[model samples]
Target: MTDAITPHPFAFPDAALEDLRDRLSRTRWPDRETVDDWSQGAPLARMQGLIDYWRDAYDWHAAEARLNALDPSTTRIDGLDIHFLHLRSPEPDAVPLVLTHGWPGSVFEFMQAAPLLADPRAHGGDPRDAFHVVIPSLPGFGLTEKPTETGWTPERTAHAWVELMRRLGYDRFVAQGGDWGYAITNELGGIGAPAVQAVHFNMFPVFETMEAVDAQEERALKRLRDFKENESGYQIEQTQSPQTIGYGLNDSPVGLAAWFYEKYEQWTDHGGDPESLLSRDEMLDNITLYWLTATATSSARIYWQSMANWQEREIEVPVGFTLFPRDIHETSERWVKERYPTLVHYNEAPKGGHFAAWEQPESFTEEVRASFRHTRQPL
Candidate 1:
């Protein structure tokens, strides 16, 4: 058997990428609007600048080559073809950590931190903290199987990932995630998987009810409501009418980039310009993943499957939760403690945005490692 059964490392062919560059160069741009602010979505002017750079300067081959240099390999667990970066530390006792990414994110999230985690001495960290990292492209998200059937919710994804780690010979390992990762990591531990010693997450959902509201929770509730009303239009579109909006995203490369540009622009603590935080090259690499795999529509299916008559799951695993300020309004500590009684460690990060894994990898990794240092492995 050939590796063709599963997506191999840096599977993107050069010819297809060249086609994308050519298409981007020939973008049928819309009429220039005389606007200084982005009251609408992606500003035509800014995106044009990015597009120009993307076409003229940004090299997909170079970016893809750098990604290829990371050494991606494939494995099988429970009849699913799992694509992952299985970077091992030099130390024999290195703790294996399984990382999962969310929608609009890929295994690329760990690209920067791979070397450091596998060899901390080179990065100024103690070797004692060295780790063997396994970053997987979730089924239907990245290079993993984009199942044509339904039932790939957070819970199911977590279950499959747990099996993935166990199959890798990690009888006891740590699990960490952000975004949809937060939801799934909770479930990963909740299922009482004996292999998963501890779970860490950057985006945790503290249960909320119409009945409970203190002064602080009340204010956060107001902010959440305000954010939803003003800034969550994209999510509403994604959650409700993904199929309808899929045409624009799937049809044109520019349209697809613009849609994602809006997210990077708004979600990031970008100081104003999306390009400031994410350069044209960095952003497009992620977009290119969707483009090459044609997984954009399939990725949206997670929202439809989960939120469409979706019910929440109960988490009973020992958890390490880090609540970022900009992350969906802070759940009252009282609420978190009450809801997640099994939570062993909780930290409130003063700085970070939704893309915690990318925005603050050092902080995110340190917190996750420290939180699970005393991982309570079950017999």
Candidate 2:
């Protein structure tokens, strides 16, 4: 495969949009949940409303235009066409930074934050905080070429990211991520890539058993336990049998919408309603990308390939972390320090959850600027 970073702008076929609308119109919905709240999964009414809006009001063309505005491109890395958005900062002294999106997420997650980070001065922040931002869709996700073969785990993805960065002329750079983005970033720092001078995570996955020495740690452990017991059914199914579920997710737009809408409801930091924080269009922007790409099964396979093999390992590079309160799992600063000895930065965001960047772009942007302030240098 050629190492060609081709300009791959968004231009979805009209027939694809027609098919999506037709599929939405003909969705075979299931019966309503017995419970009123989200305990049983996305409520039938909630999903119906969403699907109604998706079919009637949502504009895929508008979303397509937004994606194209990010300067989208693709390159063959490891025999796959990896789609990514690359934005060079106007500031000459800007530091190169790569942001990796997680499952149920696309480059759409960073649409707001990427611009803020790349042009801090334009956003009323210091020019010194500017970053040459690169947001890559994970292999088998979004517009990226789906892997036909197995073995594309997070570790392998991390290596591909390093190569992608190197090919982009970033001999030295910083990394930031959350969710599976956190997993991939963790691996990036652990693998001793000299080019990765520092790494940052909004979600630090700490699985090691340690006694809680205080109330905060105790609460964090309780949340972790709760996530494992109640909130991880999707993880179990995806890790064990992604292909089985892929059939439904790929075929039905409603199925795909409900699958991701559940997480937007359960994971975001909002009152009872996720719509209070995230607009319907914003949520659909990401969900529609998944539907258009037909990556439901392929994206799920990442969990199958990576989760069982996860191990606790020290990340030697300097690290930064911003823990959002409403996330699925919480880790005490002590736990973070244990894993990242050279901890350069850590903070608790006032708001946001699993989709931190999307939920609170301003806060997410500020955190990234602060986290890498110490690592910035002329590239």
Assess each prediction's global lDDT (C-alpha) against the native.
Answer: 0.73, 0.88
lDDT string, candidate 1, 85-199, tens digits? 7777886667888888886788777777677776787788877777788888887766777777877778877777776666666767788887777767777777764667677
| Candidate 1 steric clashes | 0
Q: What is the lDDT of candidate 1?
A: 0.73
- What's the alpha carbon RMSD for model 2? 1.2
Give the TM-score comparing model 2 with the true structure, all chains together: 0.97
| Residue 359, candidate 1: alpha-carbon lDDT | 69
Off by over 4 Å in 1: 1-7, 32-35, 76-79, 206-216, 376-379
What are the TM-scores, per candidate, against the unseen true structure?
0.90, 0.97
Best by the TM-score measure: 2
What is the lDDT, from 0 to 100, of the residue 357 in candidate 1?
Answer: 68
- Per candidate, the number of residue pairs that clash is 0, 0
Please tell me which predicted candidate would have the highest lDDT against the true structure: 2
